[model samples]
Target: MQQREEKQLESALDSLIQRVNDLKSSIAAMIFKVENEYETLNWPQFLDNFALLSGHLTSLSKLLNHDKCPPLRNLTVLPLNLSPERDEQLAQLTEGRVTTFAHDLVPDYLRTKLEPMAESKMLHFEQKAATVTYENAQKQVAAYQKVVSNIWDIVSKTREEWEVESSSRGNTQQHSSVSDTHLLVTAIGMGKGLKPNPNANGAPGQPTGGMMVPPQGRPGSAGQGPIPPSTQTMTMNKTPSTIKTNIKSATQIHPYNR
Candidate 1:
C-alpha cells in the first residue's frame, strides 16, 4: 500500500510538471507569434493557443488539488551543488555574483511572503471608482444644462420674432382697412355731390355727421345748403355756349351791378 501511494504521488508530480511545461510552451508560442509574426498571425491559431494554455492550467490546478498531492505551502527549496563549468556559465549569463539559493538573488521585499490587504485595497478602489463616477456625472449635467439653455434661447428668440411678425401683420391689415373705408367715404361723397368737411374734429379724409359741404355751381342753391336733385340735373344739362355767354355778361356788369 505504501509503495502504491508513493507511485501515485510520483505520477501526480510528473503530470503537474508536464502540464506546467505545456502551459509555458503555449505562452512562449503566443508571445513569439505576437512579436515576430504579427503581420501573418492567424486569429484561429491564437485562440487555439490560448485554449491550450487554459487547459494546461486547469489540469495543473486539478493535480495540485488532488487528495494524493502534498501541500505546496509546506514545500522547501533544497540547495544543490553546481559543477564549476555550470557555475561559470550561469555567472556569464547573469553578469553578476552567483548564489545557490534562488531567493538570495531576489530583493528582500520580493522574497518576503505577504498577506493580502483586501479590505483596504477594496475600499481604495471603491473611492476611486466613486470619484470617477461623480466627475462623469457632473460633466454630463453641465452638458445637459448647456443644451437646455441653448434650446430655451432659441425658443425665446423664435417667440419674440413671431410676436413681432404678428404685430406687423396686424398693423398692415388695420392700415388697409382704414384706407378702404376712406376710399368708400370719398366715393359716397362724390356720388352725392358732397365733400369732406375741412374743419371736422375727426381724422383727415373721414366724414363728420351733418358737416359735409355741397359742391359748387348750381342755380337757386347757396354754399350753405346742398343743391336739389332737379337743380343739379338742370345745371349738368346746360350747354357750354350758354355757360360762356352767361359768364361774359356777368363779368361785364359785375363791378357796376355790385
Candidate 2:
C-alpha cells in the first residue's frame, strides 16, 4: 500500500512538472511570435494585434499570478478617442469636406481641431503603447519562468524527501523481515525440543506426558469413555428436537409479526 501511494505521488509530481514546462515553453513561443509579428505590421494592424496579445498576457498573468507585472497600457491619462459622429466629422474636415475645400484653409483651426486625434492615433503614440505592452509582456514571461522554476524546485525537494522516506521504510521492512525469520526459526527449534519420541514404550494411546487419552464418544462428551453406537445416535437425534422446542418458545414470546 505504501509503495502504491509513493508511485501515485511520483506520477502526480511528474505530471505537474511536465505541465509547468509546457506552460513555460508556450509563453516563450508566444512572446517570440508577438515580437516577430509586431515588426511587420503598420500602426493600425500593430495596435490591433498588440491588443490581442495583451489580452493573452492578461490571461496568462492571471493564471500564474504575477503581481510584479504591471498593466499593459497606462491608465493615468484619459483616453482621447472621439465619439463616432465627431470622428466622422473630423475625418471629413481632414479631407476638406466638412467645411471648405482649398489649400490650408484653416491651418491654426485645423491644428486645434486635430490635436487630440493626433495625440491619440499618431505613430509616436502607438509606438509608445506598443513599447509598454511589450515590456509588460516580457515581464510576464519572466514571472512565468520564475513560477515554473519554483515549481520544479519544489518537485525536486519533494522527490528527495520521498527517496529518503522510501529508503528508511525499506530499511525498517528489512529489519522486520529479519526479525520475523529469526522468530520463525526459533519457534521451529522450540517445537523440535518438544517433539515426542516415536520409539518410546509409553501406553498405546497415551500422550508423551503419560496423560490418559479419552476414547472417542459424543461431541460434548470429552474425557469420557466411548458410548455405544446406538446411544450416540440417540443423543444426536435428541438435539434437533431440543432446538425446535427452544425456537418455538422464543417465537411465541417475541411474536415477530406483531
Candidate 3:
C-alpha cells in the first residue's frame, strides 16, 4: 500500500512539472511583442491588453492544475538542478537552514507526509484570501473614504501669454492662465446642488451642478469629469482615499480618446 502511494505521487508531480514547462514557452511567445507598438490607441487597446493578461493567467491555471502533484516519483530527482553541492546552495538561497534528515525518518515518510504538506499550503492561501473579503458588498461599502488622489506623469506648461483685461476691477494685467500649462491636476468637489463658486477650490466654473475641478492647470479644463489614470498611476496609488463616491448621476464622459 505504501509503495503504491509513492508511485501515485511521483506520477502526479511528473505531469505537473512537464505542464509548467510547456506553459512557460507558450506565455513567452504570446507576450514577447507587447513592447512594440504604433500610434495612439483607444479603449480597445486596453481590452486587448486585458485579453492578453487573461490568456497568460489561464495558461498559469492550466499549469497549476496540470502539475499539482507531489514529487513522489524518483523522490531522489529534485525539482531544480541537482549536484552533490546543490543542497547547500539551495539552503543558502532559501536561508531556511535545511538539513537532510534520514529519508527513513518516517516509516515511509514520502508516501505519507509531503502530500499533506502541499494540501496544507493550499488551505493556507485560501484562508488568507478570505480575510480580504474583496467581494463582499458590505465590506466594500465600508471602504468608501473622504479624500481622493491622482497621479501624473508628464507636466507640460503652456507658454505664458500676456494680456490686458478691462473689467470692473480696472485695467489689470490678466494673464490668460490657460496658456500656463501643467503636467497634471487634482481637485475635490462636494455639493448637494449645481451652483458654482469660482473661488472654491472644489468648484469647476459654471456647470450644471455638482462639479469637480482638477487643481489649477490640468490636462483638460474644469468639470471634465474623471479620466482613467495611467497604469503607473494606478500602481502608485493602489490604496487611495475615496470621496464623493456613489454620485454616478453626476458622472460626465471625457471627450479626448483615452
The TM-score, computed over Cα atoms with residue i paired to residue i, of candidate 3 is 0.24
Ranking of all predicted structures according to lDDT, beginning with the best and ending with the worst: 1, 2, 3
Candidate 2 lDDT, 78-175, residue by residue in tens: 33442323355555644544443233434444343456657668867778767777679899899999999999999999999999999898877433
User: CA lDDT, every prediction?
Assistant: 0.71, 0.61, 0.50
- Residues 27-124, candidate 3: write the lDDT tens digits: 55445544444345456865766676677667656645554444333356323332333366546643544433334422333354456679899899
Better-scoring candidate (lDDT), 1 or 2: 1
Candidate 3, after superposition: displacement of residue 147 in Å? 13
Show model 3 residue runs off by greater than 4 Å.
37-258
Candidate RMSDs in Å, in order, are: 24.4, 25.4, 34.7
Residue-level lDDT tens digits of model 1 in 135-217: 79899899999999999999999999999999898877433577778877876766443555655676544447545445655
Top lDDT prediction, candidate number? 1
Could you tell me the lDDT of residue 149 within candidate 3? 17
Candidate 2 Cα deviation (angstroms), residue 190: 14
Arrange candidates by TM-score, descending: 1, 3, 2
lDDT score for residue 58 of model 3 = 77
Better of 1 and 3 by lDDT: 1
